[model samples]
Target chain A: MKLLLLSNSAAPGRSYLDHAREVIAEHLDGVTELLFVPYALADHDGYTAKVAAFMDTLGIRVRGAHTAREPRELVASAQAVFIGGGNSFRLLKSLQRHGLVDAVARRIRADGVPYMGSSAGTNMACPTLRTTNDMPIVQPVSFDTLGLVPFQINPHYLDPVPGSAHMGETREERLRQLLEENDVPVLGLREGTWLRRSHDALELGGLAAGARLFTSGAEPVEHAPGADLSPLLAAEARFDCRPD
Target chain B: MKLLLLSNSAAPGRSYLDHAREVIAEHLDGVTELLFVPYALADHDGYTAKVAAFMDTLGIRVRGAHTAREPRELVASAQAVFIGGGNSFRLLKSLQRHGLVDAVARRIRADGVPYMGSSAGTNMACPTLRTTNDMPIVQPVSFDTLGLVPFQINPHYLDPVPGSAHMGETREERLRQLLEENDVPVLGLREGTWLRRSHDALELGGLAAGARLFTSGAEPVEHAPGADLSPLLAAEARFDCRPD
Candidate 1:
């Protein structure tokens, strides 16, 4: 029942995992090795190597699910778990293809393995991948995800740019349309921000802007950094339905 | 196969359907009554009323698919068809829900009923709705669309904004990822531009900019305004496969 959902791996001009170093360290406390899910990015080997190198700096050993004979068994016995960002649809498809969706979720919930993900990885922890901003390049068997967290996570969220000529739907409008069809709450995790879930308590963290919360029948509200976000977790209990 | 696929309904400070009035008039030549699919927008009646009022000026009568007792029958017999802009996933779901997908495609390809769509509507004309920029707020039974056109259409295409802080996938990157898993061509239609298809001929039109074509094993190529896009249609023939 522990999670560290990051909006992105790093802020602008920062190295990989630079902004999230301390948070990752704290989440992986006393852990020397972890299972890394690199299915989001297409180049499994390159992605695995890049992430493994980064984790090495944190003094943690990294093993990729791609190299495992039984990815589920690796997740079950891992000291910690992390999923990197790329295409959410691709990641979900791989998870379903490898039959690891339930395994990853069980490891995080029942086994209490510390789960960490960024971008598409963060989206994997949600009730459904419906709130993802990634293009539907591939269709997963279902939009369902791990449900490690009760609410949805929109990673790398951004407000509309001012005076811009682009006419595509803004991030907020997209989430609003999702709310019309789905009753679950959505956390708009701006870059450098993340949600920390521990048992019954959830909190927002990081610098820069606060997280934007989109709940049904309400205007989106902002939660300051380091603020307790357990209310959204509780609100998830009130709504018993998940998007089909 | 007659089609008018627009990148957007209107540009900044322009009336609804204003920029494409002449093209729409030319495409709908000799047609008095046309079928309007307004399921993309949430307010069906409001969307129908607004579009009806606008068509009144062009001396054309509009019938909404929403009010029809048999939506598929209406699509089959319509003199022409038009779908407005909104969430692509929602529109695709409604099309599948009311069983209008095949009917609309048959009307356009077999019956030669002129098909006109903006934004989500344009995406529907493609083989698959994968290239759509709209959020996947709703998961359609499938991403398959009408297949009226051989390639995918990315409406409202824009390059990365200069000095912008947004880290979401760029239009080109999203399309590139699509090409990774798909071999079909993708046309990035900038705002104010559209594709005009008549039988076997295809062309680009409008004021803003050229259309960017993303094909397999090639960097994106720009087609100047008013250029004949018939080559792409022929290439579609050589491939002999449609996106699933």
Candidate 2:
């Protein structure tokens, strides 16, 4: 299995996908066409057009899954898959509703199709959508995702603001509460950082801002770019949840 | 119906419930015993104990509903009910799992039991938990909440930071996306603000931070403390979701 899971698509001042242009190009080398899943956001055509325009500059053609008559078939025959970010619940529901969750997962595991995701797309690679920071704008069939990765991923993870007066739970506190329920590790990927998985090996790469690794009963540990995170792939995931 | 929906339980540097002590006292003027729902957080006993200790100062006796053999029956007999803050999904799931959603709603509408909620508790008063800022750490039987209010509430609503580089959805953007799917107006309550409902009357109360009101296809309008918001009680809510 090969995957490029980005924490987010854009950075502060850079254009969309500009911050990770080199990494994305290297990851999609030799791929002529990329299937784009744009169900996370409400505007499918607009989102696909934006991505298609960006990929055109790289000599790659982008086709939206929503535009296909049989999205499942598109996923099955795709050379490469790229899922963009927006709302995780909306994206998961669309994938499940269209019966493409298993198809996408099969392509990645069985056919070794290169899978790339950003933000909500990165969350889809996790065992469950339970670690997402997005609002529950919509309810999916379940919190379960593709399970492309064994552990959970909290994308665009933010640190607690210093001396802020907001009474809401910090990103870290929310992740801690998740640990209290499920026996799985969570990788809190800050913006500009990403995880690349190739079969048995996983590497953290991107800008200077690294990522935090959160495990049950242990304090979060930070890992910088170029750090090896393959050990986490071996951790077991036991979700303590019941579906109605 | 009488309700005290608080955005949060505490503010920075302030003790629990201190910010809303006077309002709480006024809301529960004639009540001697208050039933506490602590299902949002993992430590039910600890959460109940903390609220029990705080309510004791106001000459009110507090009972943990989790300790009762039949929590539904406790809601039926209670003079008032207070649900504290934590994960909204966890709170909604626990209430649904234990069959307390209808019980609490019945008490508020039929028995006129003064109802109070902080954070996740306040979110429970809405038609659904779609507007909650918390992560979807757990999937409830449904997004269907108590529906005590006709609309949704986004608690701890924060305005966009001027120059932050975080690529995650802003509080405003998330709520806007929600409007795209559902025909409902949402009340964005800031840290120190709350909504008080008494039969046909509704008012915004608390500090000067004020609150923002978001309606579909329209710009979010701001409302100051002491602003009359009863008109919103008449707005219709149509949730566009399918339960799996």
Candidate 3:
């Protein structure tokens, strides 16, 4: 399967998708048209239009899956798929309601279609949406997602601020609590980072600030931009509890 | 009904329960013993013991609900109930699993048992756990919480950092997104602040940092300490979607 899972769409000073323009272009190389899933945000047309405008600069035509009469069929016929980020719960609920979870997964894993995701969309590629930082504004049918990748992903991961007086659990603490219930590895992707999976090799790429890998009985290990994370694809996911 | 919901158990540089010692003592006036629910954290025994140590200083005997032969009976017989803070999802899951949701609610509303919650515990007093700031580390049977209060509560509410490049949604943004899905109002309780309800009166009280009240379409309004929030107790909760 081919995937480009980004941590975020924008960086500090750059416009949407501007920071990783080159990487996105290379990931969608030779592809003339791409299908965009814009269900994460409330405004589907607006989100699709924003992405289309950006993809236009890269010499590609963007079609919104929401506009398709048959979204599943659109996924099946697409040369590449891109899912933008917003609220993960809303995204998963829409995907489950539209019956596109299996359809998109089949397209990516069985048909080898290139898949790209940002923020909540990046969360969609994981086994479950359990690690997302978004609030549960709405409930999905389940925490289960595409499962295109073996482990979980915590998108937009933030390290604890030094000397902050806030008592809320830091990003690391929450992920550690997750490990107490589920024996699955979590990849905390900081902003400006993207994980590219080309066939069997998975490479972390972006500007400086890298990523952190968290496992069940160990301290989180940090990785740089060029780190090889292909081994995590073989990790087994065993959940001890379910939402229902 | 009498309730004391704290945004956090400890403020900056303060020991557990120390920041709210005077208020807690007043809230638990004439009461000698309190039943503590520690299911939010994995180590129930440790959590219960920690709360017990703090409550001892307030001249109250603390009992762990986990240690009771029948937890429901313990809730029924308690002079006051205190649910310590940890993970909201885990806390709700355990409460639902042990059949304590209804029991605790009955004690608070029907029996007038004083209910005290900190952080995740504070979230339990709301209609649902949708507004909590914690990660979905575990899935509860449902997002349904105690519903001791009419609206939702977002504990540990943090303002957006000035000029920070993080692309993740701010606390205000996430709460606004929640308004899109549910018609219920939300109370964003910042640290060093709390909500206290007695009989038919509700008041925002605690340290200097105040609270933010969020409605469906209106911009959030700020409330100072000692602000009259009794009207919110009558607000209706209408959930547009359910997890199942």
Local error of candidate 1 at B69, Å? 3.2
Q: What fraction of the true interface does each of the listed models get right, in terms of native contacts kept?
A: 0.58, 0.72, 0.75
Q: Tens digits of per-residue lDDT for model 3 on A131-179?
A: 9998988878788999989999998889999987777788999999998
Candidate numbers sorted by DockQ from highest down: 2, 3, 1
Number of colliding residue pairs in each model? 0, 0, 0
Among all windows of 10 consecutive residues in model 1 chain A, the one with the lowest summed lDDT is A235-244
Q: What is the per-residue lDDT of model 1 for residues A1-244, given as tens digits with 9 covering 90 to 100?
A: 9999999985788888888899899999999998999988778889888888888998998999989777887887899999999989888988998899998888888889899999999999987888888888877888889988778889888887888666667899898878777788888999989889999999999975979988888989988898988877765522213332
> Model 1 over residues B1-244: C-alpha lDDT tens digits?
8999999996788788988889888999899998999988778899998889889889999999999877987886789999999988989998998999988888888878899999999999888878888778777898899888777888988876788666667778888877777678889998999999988889999974778999888988888889998877765522212221
Cα RMSD, model 1: 2.7
Interface RMSD of 1: 3.6
Residue by residue across A88-173, what tens digits does model 2's lDDT show? 88899899989989999999999999999999999999999999988888777788899999999999989999987666789999
Candidate 3, residue B150: how far the Cα is off, in Å:
0.9
What's the iRMSD of model 3?
1.1
Candidate 3 residue-wise lDDT, B1-244, digit = tens: 9999999997778889899999999999999999999988889889888998988898899899899767998988899999989888888988987899999999999999899999999999998888888888887878888999899988888888988666778899898888877899899888889999998899999877799999987988999999999999889888754232
